[model samples]
Target: MSSSAILDAHQTAQALPYLALTQEIEALLQDPTVAVPPRIVQALHGGGSLFVMPAADARVAITKLISFIPTNAQRGLPTIQGDIVVFDVQTGQRIGLLDGPTVTARRTAAVSLLAAQHLAPRRDGPMLIVGAGVQGRAHLEAFHEGLGVQEFWIASRSASSADALVAHARSLGLQAQRVDDPNAALADCPWVVSATPAQEVVLSAPPHSDAFVAAVGAFTPRMVEWSAPVCQHLARTGTLVVDTRDADHEAGDLLQAGIDVAALPTLADVVGQTARWQNAHRPQGGPVFFKSCGWGGWDLAAARCMAQGIAVSSAPQG
Candidate 1:
């Protein structure tokens, strides 16, 4: 049995602030020694899956064990539930366990925000978010806090979910409204985040050039939020960047569009050359599409962020 301190969802989120999480993720991206093995998925008996994702670096290592069950929604339970186990590299001791769902939601949003900070043409306009689920809420907070975004336009298949998300956004003292059609709103909202399950296309129309769209919903080849033509158009005229190489196979929008993933740039590549790319290359590009499939490196970054916060709070002050 491991004697690791367990942090509940709220506590886990308190530790990994959006700003800090982005910093840690960017740091890990730049570190050549960090290693994130591809996630392993095991199908369960009842139409579910068990995911084992691991990532490590010189100082720490983390493994996120999670189970996803679609029927959990009917039971009023979270679809994804588990814990991220963190260990110290030198001591080889289990230091802490964080709420897995919270880490996943926050880290994924942070990754998008990190990319958006670099890719967005302008940050002051209303941001459009398709899907009003956990990722949508997380992305809202990340962009509002990280980039000072004040207005939001939300669209979802479920009207109640969209209204709920809009209310949540307004409660944060931000301006938020519901849009019946996400595609129509794309022209006005330069910053867009598509966080749906990606069963079908949620954003089909071609967005304006210089817009930044972070497609975070579709991870599998079968799931897609953007229409094939939209993806093809973006690939043709705009700049397309993915979160990781794994996206080459997992990002549905890119793969189904027959995009040459190897020919596109990764977020790490953009971050490494932010100045040069933004100045010289971005101007020549049309819209910017950033497709983020799940990555274990992000989970590891969240764990490290949480650990750093714990260390800071526990330190003896003079």
Candidate 2:
């Protein structure tokens, strides 16, 4: 029997490539036969997040637990870190262990890009990103690789941080600029993405007539990223798409900002192509918004792709 292989964080990181992983995930989502359940996400005290994601399709079952500890910053650790363990459905055997952060960041950004591809206006435009952390950088990379973004405007509370992110983007051959004012950045860019973790609003509604906004922060019931005016504007003019219907209802940003939860379409609806009706019902050429509370199915799909080489075998009988 083949021996089971163990993969450490660094090894897992070396195994997975962000752009290729994201492309594979996008293809899996486009397929109609995949079975991915709604993710279970919990918020712990002191700014932590725990998520359980499971996917099964008769042959195999993959589940991953991802935790985020924002307080780890004080310890000189990552704000987001975790692990992924895969299992074979038939024999209940452990098949693989993967780096959670790599999977999480890549899959999350891929999902956002998928949303953008399906919902955002079909044109090359400037993208304004309002965060300088891991998620923000992931969004920049994914957008550049997956979409036709011509320019990038980075905004953060710290100008230096924004400049650093812009420099990183420029290193990748993207036309990037650091902006002092997020609103000004939004006003100039037709596509805006909010990736911050603020408990309050960080950006006002952009006045652009054809802007598309992708808000991926604020997973917990206590956190929010957009103000009331922004939420209202999205509700009135744009179509709001979420990873799940339940997540849309539970998001504090939408609830606290007074945006009706019923107004958004589920990710399944969009993937299944049922959202065309919702789009047809909405007015033409308005701003479109998409918010995701994160989904596990995406993580499982990506991890399964990354676990291709590791050997899996039955354990010896006790």
Candidate 3:
């Protein structure tokens, strides 16, 4: 028999192609008959977060519980940690445990890529990153691999972090550099992704002509990664896309801006209304805002991808 082992970060990273995952996500959502929506439970504090998300279909079920400790980075520990449990739908028996961070990173980036690409008029441009933390690195790799972005510009509050991210990108044979001026840098790139945990604005300038932005930062209502003015501009001038209707409860930037959640289109709306958007295309030189708070279905999708054709053990009981 083949060996059964827990999938760690390394193995999880290569378990699936993000492009395939994004494509599969579209295919799954486009089916009008599928009705299993992801269920999520969240607990949030000033510096800590815990989230439980479960998603399933007719054949499989997966649940992932993710946590965050902000001070872990100060102690030379990773800030985010989680575990995913998989089960067989037929028997309800435990089947797999996969690393949560890897799955989260992959699925988050794939979702961001999906929204950004869907909103963008054209996908060919230097991918710009507004933060150089772990999320930034994940998106860098995701956009490069999934969307064929060959050039990168990373701007961060911490110069060292930006340099480190740039080094990692260069190591992968990608042309990358640190942005000294975020405003000027933002004005020149098309796809800008904000992956920070900042309570303030990251982009000091409006996006370049015909640019698209994927905002993945700020979860709580107190945290505002995109400034109020920028958000107002986005609401006024651009189309806003969110991952789910949960934006009303979780997305701080959208909440702080007083945006009408009903007016904001979710990912499903984007797919379902693609033709209408194209037919009613306004002037082509506006910023596109895609805000994401993540979803449980993505974690399930990642788990299935990693568990494909593999054997995994049951959960250890005390």
lDDT (Cα atoms) of all candidates against the true structure: 0.88, 0.72, 0.76
**Per-residue accuracy of model 3 over 114-177 as CA lDDT, tens digit each:** 8866778677778789888888998998898877899999989889999999999999999999
Note the clash tally of each candidate: 0, 0, 0
Task: Summarize candidate 2's per-residue lDDT along 1-318 as a digit string, tens digits.
Answer: 123445676676555555566666666666655677777778789868787878764444677777778667557677777777777666777767777877777777877887777777655678989988778888888888778575899998768778988999999988999887888667668788788866578877553667777788777667788887777777777666776665755677788877666656776677667754366436577777777777666766766566553422233445
Give the clashing residue pairs of candidate 3, or none: none
Clashes of 3: 0
Q: RMSD of each candidate?
A: 2.3, 4.6, 4.8
| lDDT top scorer | 1
The candidate scoring highest on TM-score is 1
Model 1, 1-318: lDDT tens digits are: 134668999999998999999999999889988999889988899877799999999888999999978668668888789999999888899989999999999999999999998888766678999989899999999999899999999999889999999999999999999999888899988889999877777778998777889999888777788988999998778888899888888898889889887667788888898553454355666888999998999999998897787788778999
Q: Which stretches of candidate 3 lie over 4 Å from their true place?
A: 1-5, 31-46, 274-285, 309-318
Better of 1 and 2 by lDDT: 1
Candidate number with the higher lDDT (1 or 3):
1
Candidate 2: residue 233 Cα off by (Å): 1.4
Which segments of model 2 are wrong by more than 4 Å?
A: 1-45, 275-283, 308-318
Q: If both were scored by lDDT, which would come out higher, candidate 2 or candidate 3? A: 3
